[model samples]
Target chain A: MGMKCIGIDVGGTTVKVGLFETDGTLLDKWEVKSRKEEDGKYILPDVAASIREKLAGLGLDLKKDIVGAGLGVPGPVMPDGSVEVCVNLGWHHVNPQKELSGLLDGIPVKSGNDANVAALGEMWQGGGKGYSDIIMITLGTGVGGGVILDQKILSGRHGLGGEIGHIHVRDDEWEHCNCGGVGCLEQIASATGIAREARRKMAADSRDSMLRKFGDDVTAKDVLDAAKAGDELADEVFEVVARYLGLALGQAALIVDPEIFVIGGGVSRAGQFLVDRVFKYYDYFTPISKFKAKIGLATLGNDAGIYGAARLIL
Target chain B: MGMKCIGIDVGGTTVKVGLFETDGTLLDKWEVKSRKEEDGKYILPDVAASIREKLAGLGLDLKKDIVGAGLGVPGPVMPDGSVEVCVNLGWHHVNPQKELSGLLDGIPVKSGNDANVAALGEMWQGGGKGYSDIIMITLGTGVGGGVILDQKILSGRHGLGGEIGHIHVRDDEWEHCNCGGVGCLEQIASATGIAREARRKMAADSRDSMLRKFGDDVTAKDVLDAAKAGDELADEVFEVVARYLGLALGQAALIVDPEIFVIGGGVSRAGQFLVDRVFKYYDYFTPISKFKAKIGLATLGNDAGIYGAARLIL
Candidate 1:
């Protein structure tokens, strides 16, 4: 049998697992419910047991056929593979790499931040397929990002590399982000932020638009759908999002100067329409004629995390 | 004899050269006038002649005793060590690395941006000595920067990595930066920028300031000196500078998250006074309690470039 590696993406609700040929071809994939009780004590054990069962059913020897395992966690990870805290999974000081490796008959393991891993996945086989240096911006409920430099993750000294969402974008934001900072890019560019901006815009004016039909419960998807259908108010809200997102990406370009910026997550469902608008502002802010970083949409969808996780071990 | 390397810092007016041991000790240093009369055609050849003379004087063989040469140029250098344009030196499409290596009897040669090499020099033997990752901000005639990740220069795809000075920082500025961008950090934080801001502030109001004595001849040094002596107007000017500089550094921290930021150049002569003020704002912008990047002054002054250049070959 060909050498194999296991990719594990541990989220609050579920753990996505994938078995891949060492060369990155996905051979199988599955998921198991995450158990957060008793401080996530059962989560790792469950994942290990599931992997072992899968290996047995596939008639593969763990020590002989399996190369190693790669994990994606939802919090900052020290270079030593230990997590200080993962609030989503109620984990504290967990060494997933060591623990999972131990539970898997002494196989090796590597781990990284979830957002970072997703970016690696995209670079390996998605939007950033041909690029070695990229910044992946995930515009989900909260904005997340990852920086890949020369085909390696820029994990940073504090494990805070690619935390682009928290970069201050506006000085006028009155509210705080989940990270407790004011005027963060996440405040105006994430899915929640887009909906919030839409609500605020609708509340601030008597402008007639389709977003008004949803009132306070207006969703990001609804606003984006309306904007695509030529809703002026929705279009205006996206312009605001595009401005902040573009400005932040431009700033990132100045610092890291990645070859391309891969836009992923829920808001990215708007696709090239959103990308073009953001690129306009990114270009304006950067304006370096020969050094502009390309902007593109991520293509791996939910499976990017698994792909990136596997890439860590490979 | 021990293996040796030559470090050359090519500038607009002069070239600073240093002979170094392979382990980075500065054995001897000298300078040569840069001849820019012919598109800087003689600059590298002149530097090569000077190095060979020094090596002969010291009784060292060119190919047997000298390891290589490293060059720090005044413009963006491609990964291949070729420059598209270096206006200060009147150079275009100059491959300094190949040219210097050829002139120096085929010893290896590496080249990098001047600011980047200075940062590497600082990291090798200056303020960032112990840190493998750093962002060096040079606050001179123009704000300049270099990013070192894992002890190597992050020379971006477009050679724009660590070009933090051009990062957009403000929106209210009416004047365009030298780079043709509006509200760049260099507009408020460089030595020239500080003097300009002081002049604008003095003109805006009859503010009682020691800086008023300088009239139209006010300098960044005058402003900093006055601030050191408790001039309120000067203090306000620095507050603005600190705010923008800190904000830019914070933005950089979010992307590369280096272990420390090394502040260098003319304006950095204010020393820890300027560093403390900028750190205050950097901390405010990047309020991540556990992941703060330290700020410090660059210790190596003019010789940092040569030291870093030699480090390239080593």
Candidate 2:
């Protein structure tokens, strides 16, 4: 049999594991409950056990068949493979690469930030498949980003290389962002930010629209849905979202000059519609004749982390 | 003698040439008038002749003593060592790298944008001397920039990686920038921008200050000098420059996260005082706890381009 690799995406709630061929073909995928007990000391052992059980079931030998493993963790990862801190996993100064390698019987292991790996996965097989340089923006609970230069993740000096969510966009914002800054891109472009903006817009003036029907329980999805349904008020809200997103992206292009921008996350479910809106603003902000970064939606969905993790080992 | 390299900085009116040892010791430097006649066909030949004459005078052979050559042009350069266009030099689709190599008995040659090369030069032996990742901001006739990540110039997909001047910063700007963008960082943070803002501030109100003596003939230096001498109006003008420049640098940090930002060009002559002012706003915009990019002034001045170009060959 050809050599295989393991991909692990360690989230706050669960540990996603995937067995894949070196050619990126997934053979098996499963999830294990994350045990946060005792500073999450059992997490790597649990993952190792799960992989061993799966290999045994498939009659695979670790020494002969498995090549290595790669991991995607939810925190800043230093060049030395030690994580600075992960509030979700209760991890601090943990070297997952060394621990996982030791756990898997000295198999070679590598790791990167979850968002950065996901971007690598997308570049390897998703929206940024054909492009080498890319920036992936995830508008989930908070605005997250990953910068891929020359097909490698730019993890930066403090592992803050792709932290685009914190780019300040507004000057007059009164409220502070979760990062303690006011008017960050995350404060206006994230799913939470979109919902908050919807609520604020609704409160500012009584507009007759479908978003009003949701009352104070409006979500980003509802606002997107309402916009698609031709509601003027919700469309206005999305316009605001697109403006900040596009502006931030434009500014990012001035620095990295990626060939394409692949946008992912739950908010990307709006598809090409959101991509188009953001591109308009991106074009407006970057007036250089050579401004030619194409915007597209990510295709890997939830499995991007696993795919990216596997790519890391390869 | 040890192997030596040649660094060429091509400008509109003059071409600066430097001969250096592989270790970056500048042995000799000179300049030649740029001959724009005949579509700049004489530019390369003239540079090649100058280098040969200098080598002959030193009794050095091209094949035995010279390692390679590098060129820094005032335009975008593609990955294939070709320039898209240099309007200042009337160049279109020119491959200086290939042509120069042929001219120098087929020695290896490399080329990059002038601003990007300057950044590399600063990173190698100037203000960013000890840093591996840096962004060099040149606030001159225009706000030019070069991004150096991992000690190499990031000349982006279209060679616009460090084009920070075009980043849109204000939504209320009515005047169009040279690049056709409105409210670009260049329009607010550049030398011309500082002078323009100073004039506008002086005209907006009859405030008794040192700038009143210059009236309509005020220059960026006049404003900076007055500010340094405790002129409130001039100080206010510099505050605006600092605000825009700091905001742009903070946003740049979110993308590439360089270890240091080296401020260059004529305006940087204000030195540490200006650096301190810009840092204040850069700090306010980037509130991440791990945000730690230091700001400093470039030390090499004009020689940065030649040093950076030679480093390119090394």
Candidate 3:
């Protein structure tokens, strides 16, 4: 007697789709190539067609098999179900909820920001399982995060809440951030930022290192692997990047003080070593001893966004 | 029939007490000399006797007239109602809620940190009135603040959730903050910090100013008053202090993104001038153009703690 729900996580390159039981059991999962044609006009329709085909293939009917659906958009989502702006999806001046709801024949679609959706997913069944208050940071191409307090996401009035990546962690920064800000935490904590720091360090120090030959092709993974291999230069690069990340996190701890911090994104594949390094600086920067937020790696990985989206409506 | 409740704001020097109706109407208010002798052994007992005498004078029965009592202590309060430490009250490892509950003859008592309680009070009837999500900064002898999201205080796991003063905004600070941190927001935003900055300016620049004559007797009020008089030196000092304070606040906006920021305490008395100055820098620091958090002066002032404490039980 269980019903199914569709979860959609909209990304820059593709859309992740998951069919799940109301009890959070994943029945099936697939992907849809995100066609940015006509300013994302066909995206929602494509999603609806995918769900309808899936339902027909499984011999399930709407209203009987699926009650509702949720979406995690690659942009800031207002509490009123409107998308402020989505640079990646060409989503501008759009209300995804109302638009998608009409397309789905009033299936009661709910939407949230992708990062916030991922956080809700983590809280629901990922690394933040059994935890209500949490902050999850994704350190892939960029540093993005979501905050959950009192069992609900803090989306803020203008959809700017949980924008932890943009907090100014350095005062001496000379370069401009993508957000037009100076010295944003994202500049030093993102995977791209790690590689940039490593490149700068190698250029300045003239040290013997495994990354000496890679030059501009060096990735954040290379830095982590070299550090793991005990390359002194790579380890030093790791420590500097980790220090800034920890300071930003430690400052956040002083602000919201969540129960646990769930680290995710492609860069988090470095695993326990990254968590341990971030926590070491986090502990030193945080003043109080009794207050400690447990650090854990994301268990859901790519599925976190979709699960969080489904949970948004569920 | 309006039932009365006693709201207590426990500070280091004096305890501000208020008699309020259950619906939040204040009937009367008074202050008591805080006798911190012998590790504050007599403090609670003294408060209890004072309340009993007041009730007797009014011919009110405890069980019939008073429904609840709340205290806002000047320290972190655990969920179980214990204060970890209170430097001013000489309290260490004391259960203020339990001790006060017993002293008041089993009357229901609830407590919270003074700043957290103050935030609740502001949310209830002050600058944050009708707004549940808010951040209130009290720039008194030290910089203290409280954060409320989704209509509840985030006291945190270690009772350190709302310690906004401790966010490290500067990396080059030479002197240590009272909390042992370097270059904390409190070191530049508090009244003492402002005066300290003003003193440093006076010592460094040979600018002829009214503050230079006052020597170490200069206060934050003096600097603000001088700036109001169009003192060039005072304006420069105000600019620097306001810059740091604004940067710290801008960093916070990126993190919590609350609906409003209530500025209170001694320094806030500098009034609209200070608020405008902060907003000027806040706007420059926040990345998003659509994002905005309304700034307002705290209306409750010193009585905010008592009202907030009373709110705990109400």
| Position B90, candidate 1: lDDT | 95
Q: Is candidate 1 or 3 superior in TM-score?
A: 1
Decreasing lDDT order of the candidates: 1, 2, 3
Query: Tens-digit lDDT track for model 1 on B1-314?
Result: 58888889999999999999888788999999999998999998999889889888999898898888889999998888889999999999889899988898788999999999999999998989989999999999999899998899999998988999999999888899988889999999999999999999999978688999898899999999999999999999999999999999999998888999999999999998999999999999988646688999999899999999999988
> Which regions of candidate 1 deviate over 4 angstroms?
none
Weakest ten-residue segment in model 1 chain B by summed lDDT: B284-293
Which of the two candidates, 2 or 3, achieves a greater lDDT against the reference?
2
What is the Cα-based lDDT of residue A129 in candidate 1?
97
Best by TM-score: 1
For residue A78, model 3's alpha carbon misses the true position, in angstroms, by 1.1
How large is the C-alpha RMSD of every model relative to the true structure?
Answer: 1.2, 1.5, 1.8
How good is model 1 by TM-score?
Answer: 0.98
Predicted candidate 3 versus true structure: per-residue lDDT over A19-93, tens digit per residue: 888888888998888889888888888888888888899998877777788899988888898986799888888
Off by over 4 Å in 2: none
By DockQ thresholds, what CAPRI class is model 3? medium
Model 1, position B75: C-alpha lDDT score? 90
Clashes of each: 0, 0, 0
Chain A TM-score of model 2 comes to: 0.98
Give each prediction's DockQ, rounded to 2 decimals.
Answer: 0.82, 0.83, 0.70
Ranking by DockQ: 2, 1, 3
In model 2 chain A, the worst 10-residue window by lDDT is A283-292
lDDT of 3 by residue, B82-141 (tens): 887898899999999889889988989998899999998999878899998899999999
